[model samples]
Each structure stands twice: as structure tokens, then as C-alpha cells.
Target chain A: MNLIVAILSGAVVYAVSVLYAGIGETFTERSGVMNLGVEGIMLMGAMSGCVTAFHTRNLALAMLIVILTGAVLGLIFAFLTVTLQSDQTVCGMAMLILGTGLSGFLGEDIASKPINLKFTKIPLPVLSEIPIIGDILFNQNLLVYIMYLLLPLATFYIYKTRWGLKLRALGENPAVLDAAGENVFAMRYGYIVFGTTMMAISGAFVSLAQTNVWQEGMTAGKGWIAFALVAFSSWNPATLALGALLFGFISNLGSNLQIYLPGVPTEIFSAMPYVATIVVLIISTGNFRKKHTAEPAALAKAYDRESR
Target chain B: MSAMNKFRFEKREKQSALRTLIITAVSVLLALVCCGILIFSVGSKPLKVYETMLTQVFLSPTGIKNMLRSSLPLMFCGLGVALTFKMNLNNIGAEGQYAAGVIAGGAFVLFGPDIEGVPGMIITALCCFLGGAIWALICAIPKAYWGVNESITTLMMNYIALMILAYLCLGPWKMPRQNTGMTERIPRSMDIPEIMIGDIQISVGVFIGIIVAALIYCAYKYTTGGYQLTVISKSPKSAQYAGISIKKNILMVMSLSGGLAGLAGFMQYAGVAHRIVENMPNNAGYTAIVIAYLSRLNPFTVVVVSILFGGLQNSTAYVQSLGVPSQIATMMQGVIMIFVIAGDFFQRYRLVIAKEGKA
Candidate 1:
């Protein structure tokens, strides 16, 4: 019983980090832009968040810095892919390499040190007493709580709002949006910046809230996993949340199983999340019926108004 | 919005070779300027840093040898990446393929029959090539059959390959009496030979890489298969209309790409590391992507570009000596790529002042 609670709690922590990135990517893809630099951007966020928290001893300030860093990167991506009409995949690769290298170079001084400030878990009073559910969901850091609010709000905004319809329309058929006198470029830029900001905060959650220390490439491949989760969720915010939790559960299960099954190599467990991601990707995309899946039609393609 | 009306872009039908060269030079200069600003922020003189970097990487005997050594894997991986890029298949799984190559080559040396001399080298190389090709086929088969995105699948497979390698080195194949994750070294007899010219030693693997690059260049230029790949990359629908088999081409090109990358892993293991250590292929696969792009996917150009990139990599030690982080090389590579990609825009379109009647 104790071990179950521990695993559940660990799963939530893992879920929250990826959940932030998954949600952000969902928005970006919905706007018909595929940003493959999530891993590199997350590394930048981790390094920036750790450095700010270490220097200012202010978690709020660190969070803001991380978000700003993500926005700056998004601006560059938008200029290249949206404005200059460069290849999205190549641009994303460049961003990933740049972000990874810059983070390592800039964070070298503080890589060895731990931040003095960290986001502490704030347990709700009445919810804390609600059996197993309370301990796993309510006993998380402030970032998790923010995510809880953001997930539902994002779902509502994406489904119910006028802007959300326009965003989805842009991904499906930008020409149709253009025919309706909507600014395709501006809408894409807006969602892209917003999405990248969310991705950065996810990185901040890892360094400031989860680990409280900055390590080179600490985000590892979580950025890639987040990307896979976006595909698994089929571009829906609510389904994305669920997918994040599933991946988190699988990720935590690996470590937990390692303790119970000592004979098995830990590498197998470490690789579970990635293996699951690939399998899920193949299954989700393998279907021949285009109507069944929710992949953005314009995903990874450059939009040009004059070409058509 | 008002500022956007000042200029408009006009598409160029074709870019002259001289114009392409000039634009490329400008991109490199722009990238240097950006890095210079970064260096300035870090309190270092960019000119002095660059001079020392160049001198250490090209002028010194030790630097030249190290550059050649690093260039081997980059050349191999670059050639592999170039093949896929030519076919418009984004196969970023070179990293995984490289790891699989090391594992296969290592397995042959450790568990296979105790053969000596040239036949043993032949067997090990074949096994490594097969390992990489098989690893790549995991993604290739799916993509060819289902139209699945190879980029994400290939990237995800990298982690799986690395995990398999980690398991082997840490568990079953671990070197005796060592706590580290590394396999036993291959016998000296099985090691790839190196030629010493005066004081500098150059691995024969470098020559192999160049030979492979030349062969690929020939294949791309002179073969019917190459012409089919070009058509497919330009327009898959057109290729289908022309009766070119898209599935067969995807499988063929991807396998060749993977095979080349696997050979890179074999080179790293047999010529450089001599063991399947944890950090054996260290970002060579990723670096090769940059080399492939910078060289415009030309196999011969890949060789020249790989040498340049190899020199930058070898200069990490010199940069670290001046208190600059070695990651400066990585950062510079990224910056250069960004600028070059952005510059490619100018090759296709030219900016002109908008006419009064234009929107």
C-alpha cells in the first residue's frame, strides 16, 4: 500500500513536467507549425530557471525568466519558418542544436551548484485527508496546481472560444482562414509564442520544482517524450493531459519495478517510456482513414499566401 | 503592418554558382559576428580566440592528427545523412545506427570465432553494417508502408538503441573488475591499422570514409537508382506517375544511409576507442547532420566540410585553455547553420522596394 502511494506520487511529478510541454506543443501544432526544438528549449529553460533562482532566490522571477527565454526562441522560429519560409524541420534542428549548446555554455558556472530556493509542496487542508487520491494529486508543488488550472482552462479555450476556432482553422486550411480575412501569420505567431512559453515553464518545473539543481542536459529526452505525447493525444488538450499521465505512470513504473525485480537490467526500465512512445506513434499514425486521426493538415509545411 | 509594405520579395528562377558562393560566405560572416557578440559578453576577444582556434586546429601537428581522427566518423555519418537527405527522408537515427554498429562489431570481436588477419576485419565490418541497416529498417518499413513520419520514429529509436547499449555494457558485457559501463577491448590483432607520416599518425578508417564518400558520389551522379531518388525527393507524386517504386526506393536509400552510419560506429570502436565505452560515438551523428546541410548534401563536399567541422571539434581543448567553454564549438555550429539556412532564402528570392499599386 505504501509503495503504491509512492509510485503514484512519483508519477504525478513526472506527469506534470511533460504535461506542460505536451499542452504547449498541442497549441503550436494546432497553429500548423511543428517545433522540434522542444528538447533544446527545455534545456534552456532549465538552465535559466536554475540560474535565476540561485541568484535572486525568487521562484517567481525565475519562472518569468524561463518563459521569456522560450518566447525569444519562439520568435526566432516564427521568423524562420513562418516569415522567411525556411524548412521547418531544418530550422527546428538548428534551434535544438543552438539551444543545447548555448545552455551548456551559459550554465557552466552554475552547473555544479544547487539553487537555494525551490517550489515546495503545499498540501490542501481537506483534500489531504481524502485517502489515496488526496496524497497523489493534492500533495504536489505549486506548478502542479497551476497545471491543474491551466489544463481545464486550455481545454475550454481551445474548444469554446472564437480565437480557438481560428487557431484550428489555420492548421486545417490557412487559405480558408485567409479567405475569411483572418491574419494567418499573426495568429500562428501568437500561438507559437504562447506555446513555447509553456514549454519553457515546463523546463522550469523540472529544475526549480523537481530537482532544485541545474545539470547539463538535465531535461534529457523529456522534451522528445513530450513531443510524442502531443501526437499520442491527437492534438486535443484534454486527451493530452491523459496521455501525459499514462507516460508518467510508465516512466515511474520502470524505477519502481527495478526495486522489486533486481535481476532485470535497469536500462530496460529506463527505456520503457521511449519504447511506449514509438509504439503509440506507430499505432496512432498507421491508420489509413484520415478522418479518424487529428493530425494538423499543415503540420511541418510552410504557409505561403501567394503560392497557391 | 505599415512597415511591411516598404519591400516585397520576388522569387528568383535560378541562382548562379558565384551568387551561391557569395551568399554562403556572407552567412558564415554573419554567424561569426553573432558568436563574436557572445564572446564579448563573456569578456573574451573574439579575434584572438578565433586566431588561436585556427592555429591550434590547423597549424599544430597534434591538432591536425586529432582533426583527421575526429573527421573519420563525421565523414561517415555525413555521407549517410546525405544519402537520406537526397531522397527527402529525414533519417535522424544515425546516432542509433552508430550505436548498433559498435554493438555488432563488438559482439563479433568478443564472441565470434578467434579468427586473425584480414578475414576477421571483413567479418566485423560486415556485421556492423548489417546491424545498422537492420536498426534503420525498423523505421523505414513503417514509413514506406504507412506514410508514417520517420523523423520522430528515428529520434525515438536512438534512445532505445542507447538503452540496449547501456544494458550490455553495465550488465552482460561489462569489462571484468571495472565499475564503469564499458566492454572489454578488442584484441590488438583485430584493431584497424594506422599509418604514421613522420610524427603524425592517421587512421586507415579515414581513407575508408573518403573512398565510401567517392563511391556514393558516383552512385548519386551516374546511377539510375540515384535519378529515381532525385525524382522522388522533388515530387513523390511525379515519381509515382513516372513508375518509380517509392517503397523500394525508401527502403534502399534508408538502408544505405544506415549502413554508412554503422561503418562510422565501427571506425570509432575499432580505430579510436577500441572498446564499446559509454560515450563512444559522442554527438558525431548529430554533428554529421550539420556537415551534410553545410555541404548541401554533396558527398565530396561532405568530406571537405567534415574536415572543417572536425577542426572546430579538435579546437575545444584550446578554447577551454582560454577559459571559454568547449560548448562554444557546438553553439557556433548551431549559429552557422541558422544563418546559412536563413541565407538560403536569399538564394530563392530577392527583396525589392514595393510598387505603389502593390498591397
Candidate 2:
């Protein structure tokens, strides 16, 4: 029972971090922009958030700084990829390198010190009274509860809202969206910035809430896992949430197994999530039929008005 | 109508060499200025730091040797990356491939036959090449057959590769006398030979890297396979229409790329480190991507760019003396990449003022 509770709670915290990034990436991909710089953005967020929290001792201010940083970086990416029509893959790579380097350079001093302010688990009074599920859900940090709201809201926004329809349409066929007299470029810019802001928040959550300390490359490969989660979930926010949870569970299970089954190599456990991701990616993309797959048709292509 | 006219961008038929050089210089200059601002913000004198880096890296013999040593792996990895980039296959798995190579080549030195000299090195090189090729095939096969995103697959594989490398180093292959996460050192006979010119000593691996670059340049410019790769990269549909097999090309290019990266790892181990340890590759594979891009995937140009980047990396130690963090080098690399990528746009298209009645 204790193991089950531990696993469930661990999974939730882990899921919240990736879920934020997954949802952000889902939105960006839905608008046909694939930002491979999520890892770098997360690092930037973690560093900035930790530094802000270290000085000001305010969690909210740290998060706000993360969002602002994400917005600025996203704007730079959008300008290069969308406005200048540069190769998205190369641009994303450049962003990743830039983010990682800059964050490491800036966070050198703070990495050695731990921030005082960190997000603590906020238990809801009424919700905390429920059985196993309540403890797992309500006993999580504030961001976890926010994530619960975000998943459904994102779903409804993506499926039901007019803007959401246009966003999906932008990914599938930007020319059609342009023909409908909508500004495709502006929509992409907005989604990219909003999505990356979420990615930054996810990073902040890792350093400020999950670990409660600053470290270089603290996000590790969580951003990459989140990026993979977008594909694993087929660009659906609800599916992405479930995928994040599934990955988080696998991640938790590995660590738990390390404690319980001490004889087994820890490296095997460390390699599990990545190996599973590759297997899932293969299976998801292996299907022959196009209709079964929910990949954005114009995922990495630059929209050129003149070319069309 | 005149009032309504605005500036427009015109695609150039061809960007002249002089124009490209100018644009590249401007981009690099702009990146330096941006990095200078960052250095200033951190309360450091940017010019003093730059001067120290330049003198310590280029003006000193010891610095030049260190720079050349660092450039060896980068040149090899850069050429490897360039191979995949030529086919538009984003194989960011060079880091993993490098590790795989070290494992394969290092394993040969540690546990293989007690052979000595040229025969031993040849066998080690072959083993490393095969290891890298096989590691890269993990992603290439899926990408070729199922259209799996190579970028993500390759990136994920890197973690798995590193984990496996770590497991081996810390477990089975660990040196018997030490508890550190490192493997047994290779025998003295297995060490790669170095050449001495006056007071400077350079490894044979550097020459190998140059030879590989020249060979790749010839292959890319003058071979049928290169032509097929170019066609496939430009438009896979056209390549398919031309009876070129996309799957075969992907496997071929990816294998070659991985093999080269693996050779780089082998060089670093056999030529320099002489032991398999965690963090051996450091971020050479990632840095190689930047070198490949900055050189526009040209093999010869990759060699030149790698040397410059190598100098930047070597100067980190010198920069650290001025109270600047070593990460400043990495940050500068990132800045250079972003600026160069942005500058590439100008080479392809020229911004011009619109004239009345142009539309």
C-alpha cells in the first residue's frame, strides 16, 4: 500500500513537469512548428527561476520571469523560423545550443547555492478526505492542480473553440487558413510564444518545486521526454496528459525498482524511459495507414506566401 | 500607388563568394558583439577576455597544440554530421555513436588479442567504425522504413548509449585497483602514435581527420552516390522518381555519419585520453553540429571551422583566469550559430526597397 501510494504520488509530480511541456509542445506542433529547443528552454527556465527565487525568495516572481524568458526566446525562434523562413530543424538546434550555453553561463554562480523558496504540496481540505485518489491528486503541489485544470481547458480550447479549430487547421493546411482571411503568421507566433512559456514554466517547476534546488542541466532530459510525449500522444492534449502520466509512472517504477531490487543495475533503470520512448515512437509511426496517425501535415514546413 | 509601395525581398540567383564571406564575417562580428554585451553584463571586460583567449589559444605553442588536439574529434564528428545533413537527415546521435565507438575500440584494446602496432590499430578502427554504424542503424532503419522522426529517435538513443557506457565503465570494465567510474587503460602498445615538430607534438589522428575530410569532399563533389544523396535531399520524391532508393541512401549516409563519429571517439580514447571514462566525449558531438552548420556542411570548410571552434574551447582555461566561467565558450558558440543561421537568409535573399508600380 505504501509502495503504491509512493509510486502514484511520484508519478503525479513527474507527470506535472512533463505535462506542462507536453501541452506546450502540443500547441506549438498543432500550429505546425516543431521546437526541438524545449530542453534548452527548460534549462533557461530552471536557471532563471532558481536565480530569481534565490534573490527575491518569491516563487510567483520566479515563475513570471520564466514565462517572460520563454516569451522572448520564443519570439526569437518565431522571427527566425516563421518570419525569416529559416529551416526549422537547424533553427531549433541553434536555439537548443544557445539556450543550454547561455543558461549554463548565467547559472554558474547560482548552481552552487540552493534557493530558499520552493513550491510545497498544497492539500485541499475537502478533496484531501477522499480515498487513495484524493491523496494522489490533492496532495500534489499547486502546479499539479493547475495542470489538472490545464488539460481539460486545453482540450476544450483545441477542439471546441473557433481559434482552436483555426490553430489545428494551421498545422494541417496553412494555405487554407490564409485563404479564409485569417493571419496564419500571427496565430503561429501567438501559439509558439504561449507554448514555449509553458515549457519554461515546466522547467521552473522542476528546479523550484520538484527538486527545490538549482543545478546545471537540472531538467536533464525531461524536456526531450515531453517532446517525445507530444508524438506519443498524437498531438492530443488529453492523450498527452495520459502519456505524460504513463511515462512518469514508468520513470517512477524504475527508481522504485532500484530501491526494492537493489541487485539490478541502476543504469538499466536509468535507460528504461528513453528505450521505451524509442519503442513507442517506432510503433506509433510504423502504421501504414495515414488516417490512423494524427501527425501535423505541415509540421516542419515553412509557410511561404510567394511560393504557393 | 507610390505611397503604397513598400520594401520587398528578392531571391538571388546566386550568392557570390565575396558576398558570402562578407555576410559570414558580419554574422561572426555581430555574435562577438552580442557575447561582449553578455560579458559586460556579468561585470567582466569583454575586450580583455577576448584578447586573453586569442593570445593564449593562437599566440602560444602549448595553446596551439591543445587546440589541435581538441580539433581532432571535432573535425571527425563535423564531417560525420555533414554527411547526414547533406541528405537532410538530422542525426543528432553523434554523441551516442562516439560513445559506442569508444566502447568498441576500447574493448578491443582491453580484452582483444594481444596484437601490437599497425595491425592492432587497424582492427580497433574497424571495430569502432562498425560499432558506430550499428548504433546509428537503430534510428536509421526506423526513419527509413517508417518515417520515424530521426531527430527525436537519435536524441533519445543518446541517453541510452551513455547509460550503457556508464554501466560498463562502472561495472564490468571498471579498473580493478580504483573505484572511480572509469575502465582499465589501454596497453602502451595500443596507444596511437604522435609526431613531433620542434617543441610541439601532434597526434596522427589529426592527419587522419584531414584525409577523411578530403575524401568526403571528393565523394560529395564527384561521385554518383553523392549525386543521388543530393537529389534525395533536394526532393525525395524526385529521387524516387529517378529510381533512386531513399531507404538505401538513408541507411548508407547515416551509417557513414555514425562511423565517422565513432572514429572520433576512438581517436579521443586511443589518441588522447587512453581510457574509457564518463564524460569522455564532453559535448564534442553537439559542438560538431554547430561546426557542420557554420561550415555549410562542406567537409573542407568543416576542418577550418573546427580549428576555430577548437581554439575557442581550448581558451576556456585561459578565460577562467579572468573570473569568467568556462561556459562562456559554449555560450559564444551558441551565439555564433544563431547569428550564422540568421545571416544565411541574407545570402539567399536580398532586401530591396520597392519602386512605384512594381506590383
Candidate 3:
């Protein structure tokens, strides 16, 4: 019972980190823009957020810096893929390289140093006392709490509202939206910047809330896994949050299993998450499962109003 | 919104090679300037950093040799990446494939019969190629048959490959008496001879890379397989209509690409490291993507660009002495790739400034 509770609780820490990016990437993809550079942007956010916390010792300031860094990167991506008509894949790769290098170059001085003030787990007043479920779900940092709220809000925003319909239309066929007197270019830029900012916050979560120390290339394929989760969720924000926790549980199973099965090489356990990601990705996409995919119809295609 | 409307973009009818070259050059210069500013912002002298970086990488003997040495793997991986890229397939798992090659090739050297000279080299190369080809084929099946995204699957496989490598080094294959994750070194006979010119030694791997690139260049220009890939990439529907087996070609091309990257792992043992170690390829696989892009997927240009990019990586050590981070080279690569990607847009479209009333 103790071990099961321990595993379930430990899964939240892993799930929360990726949940931010997975949900963020879902939003970006839903808007018909594929941002493969989530890994890179997350690195930048980690660096800037770490540096900010070290200097100011203020979590709010660190988060602001993280969001700003993400915004600038998103603008660059939007300009390249949307305005300049560059290939989204190439541009995203460039963003990844740029983020990895730029963050490493700038964050060299601050790497590996722990910050004074990191986000601590805060139990809610009433919710914290509510049996086993509360212990596993509610006893998390501020970011986790925010995510709990953000996930549902995001789902409602993407599905239930008037703007949600427009957002969906922009992805399915921007021309149809344009024919309805809407600005496809401006809307893409908005959702892209907003989505990338979410990814940046995801990185800040790693540095400020989770690890409490800054490291180079620290997110360590969490961003990529988040990228996979976006697909696993079928591009739905609600399902994305759920998938993050499930993938988290699966990835953490390796580490937990190593305790019971000591003789087996740890690498086998460590590799479980990535191997599982591939299997899940294959299943979710098209083989031996439902042929359901929510991939945007106009995804990765540059919108040119002038061209037929 | 009104501000964005000030500029109009028109699609270019045809792409000009010279225009692309000029744009690429300008973008590189622009990225350099940005890096210079970044260096200055960090309290280091940008001019001093660049000067020492250039002198060390270009003029010093050790720097030049190191530059060439680094270029060896880049060339191999560059060729590998360029191959899949030409067919519009993104096989970013060269890092994992390189590891697979090393593990496979290293296993043969450790356990197989002790052969010497040319025959030894041939068998090692084949073993490495088979390893990479098989690893690539694992993911290719899903992509070819079921329309799975090759990019994500390949990237996911990289972590798994590294894990397998980690298991080998830390478990059964751990080097005797050393607590590190490294396999036993290959025999001295397996090492390729290096030609010494003055204080610099050039590994035969450089020549092999050039030869490989040349062979790839010829195959794409002259062979039926190359023509088929060209058709498949340009228009998949058209290729299907013409009876080109997309599934077979995807599997074949991906394995060939992985095999080339596998040879890069061979260069690690034969030319430099002499033992299969973790993080062997480093970011060479990732860097190869940028190199392939900058080279416009041309095999010949891939070599030249790899050497230059290799020099950039080599120069970082000199710059680091002056308080600049070694990551400056990596950062500069990101900047350069962004510029080149942006530069590609100019070739496809022409930007025009239009007055609002003109509409």
C-alpha cells in the first residue's frame, strides 16, 4: 500500500512538468502551427527562469522572465513559418538548435547552482485532508494547482466558446475563416505566442519548482515526450492533461521497478518511457487501433491569402 | 494588423541557385553579428574572441587537425541525413543509429576472430552498417506501411539506443578495471593510418568521407533508385500513379541512410576514440540536420559545409579561454541554421512593400 501510494504520488512530479508543455504544444498544433522547438524553448525558459530566481529570489519575477523569453521565440517562429513562408519543420528545427545553443551559451555561468527560493508543495486548506486521493492530487506546488485549473479552462476555451469555434476553423481551413472576414495571419501569431509561452512556463517549472537547480539541456527529452503526448491526446487539451499523468506513471514505473528487480540493468528500466512512447505513438496514429486523429487539416502549411 | 499589411509577399516562379548562395551568406554574416553582440553583452570583447577563434582554428596545427577530425563524423552523418532529407523523410535518429553501429561493430571486434589490415576494416564496416540498417528498419516498417510520423519515432528511438548502449557499457561490456561506461578498445591493427603533413595528421577517414560523398552524389544523379526518390519527394501522388513502390523505397532509403551514419560510428573507433563510449556522436547527428539543410541536400556541398561547421566547433575552445563559453559554437550553429532556414524563404518568395491604397 505504501509503495503504491509512493508511486502514484511520485508520478505527479513527472506528470506536471510534461503536462505544461504537452498542453501548450496541443494549443500550438490546434492553431495549425507545429512547434518542434518546444525542447529548445523550454531550455531557454529554464535558463532565464533560473537566473531570475537566483538574482531576485522571487518566483513571480522568474516566471515573468520565462514567459517573455517564450514570447520572443514564438514571434520569431511565427514570423518565419507564417509571415516569411518558411517550412515549419525546418524553422522548428532551427528554433530547437537555436534554443539549445543560446541557452547553453548564456546560462553557462549559472549552470548547476541551486536557487534559494523554489516552489514548495502547498496543501490546500480542505482538500489536503481528503483521504488518499487528495494526497496524490492536491499536494503539489503552485504551478500544479494552476495546471489543475488551466487544463479545464483550456479545454473549455478550445471547445465550448465562440472563439473556440473560430480557432478550430482557423486550423481546419484558414481560407474559410478568411472568407468569413477573419485575419488568419494575426490569429496564428496570437495562438503561437500564447502556446510557446505555456511551454516556457513548463521549463520554468523544471528549474524553479521541480529541480531547484539550473542545468544545461536539463529538460532531457521531456519536451519531446510532451510532443508525443500532444498526438496521444488527439490534440485535445483535456485528454492531453490525462495522457501526461498516464505517461508519467508509465515512465516512473521503470525507476520503481528497479527497486524490486535489482539484477536487471537499470538502462532497461530507464529506456521504458521512450520505448513506451514509440509504442503509444504508433498505436495512437494508425496501427492496430482506432483510425482517429485530430491533426489539423491546415497544419504546417503557410497561409498565403493571395495564392489559390 | 494594419502594420503587417504594409509588406506584400509574392511567390517566386523559379528558384535561383546564386540567389540562395547570396542569401545564405548574408544570413551567416547576420548571425555572426548577433553572436558578436551577445558576446559583448556578456562582458567579453567580441572582436578579441573572434580574432583568437579564427587564428586558433585556422592557423594553429592542433586546431586544424582537430577541426578536420571533427569534420570526419559530420561528413558521414551529413551524408546520412542528406540522403533521407532528399527524399523528404526526416531520419533524425542518426545519433541513435551511430550508437547502434558502434555497439554492433564493437561487439564484432571484441568477440570475433582477430583479423588484420584491409580485411579487418571491411568486416568491421559491414558489421556497423548492419547494426544501423537494422535499427533504422525497425521504425521504417511503421512509417512505410501505416503512415506513422518518422521524425518522432526516430527521435524516440535515439533514447532507447542510448539506453541499450548504457546497458552494455555498464553491464557485460564494462572496460576491465575502469569504472567508466566504455567497452574494451579495438586492436591497434584496426586503427586507420594517419598521414602526417608538418605538425598536422589527417586521418584516412577524411578521404573515405570524400569518397562516400562522391559516390552518393553520383548515385543520386545517375541511378534509377535516386530518380525514384526524387519523384517520391517532389510529388508522392505522382510517384504512386507511376508505380513507384513508396513503401519499399522508404525502408530501403532509411536503412541506407542509417548505414551511412553507422560508418560515422566506425570513424569514432577507427580514427579517434578507438573504443565505443557513451555520447560518442555527441550532437553530430543533430548538427548534421543543419549541415544537410545548409548544403541544400547536395552531397558535395555537405562536405564543404561540414568542414566549415567543424571549424566553428573547434574554434570554441580558443574563445572559451577568453571567458566565452564553449557553447558559443553551438549557439552560433543555431543562429546560422535559423538564418539559412529564413534564407530559404527568399528563394521561394519575393517580399514587396505595398502601399495600403494600392489594393
Top of the candidates by DockQ: 2
Residue runs of model 2 more than 4 Å from their true location after superposition:
A289-292, B1-4, B197-200, B356-359
Model 3 Cα lDDT, one tens digit per residue, B47-72:
99889978889778888888888888
> How would the docking of model 2 be graded?
medium
Reproduced native contacts, each prediction? 0.67, 0.74, 0.79
Looking at model 2, the pairs that clash are none
- Please provide TM-scores, in order, for all candidate models, with all chains considered together: 0.96, 0.97, 0.96
Q: Candidates' DockQ values? A: 0.72, 0.78, 0.75
Residue B105 lDDT (model 3): 91
Give the CAPRI class of candidate 1: medium
Candidate 1 C-alpha lDDT tens digits along A77-128: 8999999989888888888888888888888878869787899999988997
Residue-level lDDT for B141 in candidate 1? 93
Give the worst 10-residue stretch by lDDT in candidate 1 chain B: B1-10
Question: Considering just chain B, what TM-score does every model have?
Answer: 0.93, 0.95, 0.94
Query: Judged by DockQ relative to the true structure, which candidate is superior, 2 or 3?
Result: 2
Candidate order, DockQ descending: 2, 3, 1
Predicted candidate 3, C-alpha RMSD: 1.9
Candidate 3 lDDT: 0.86
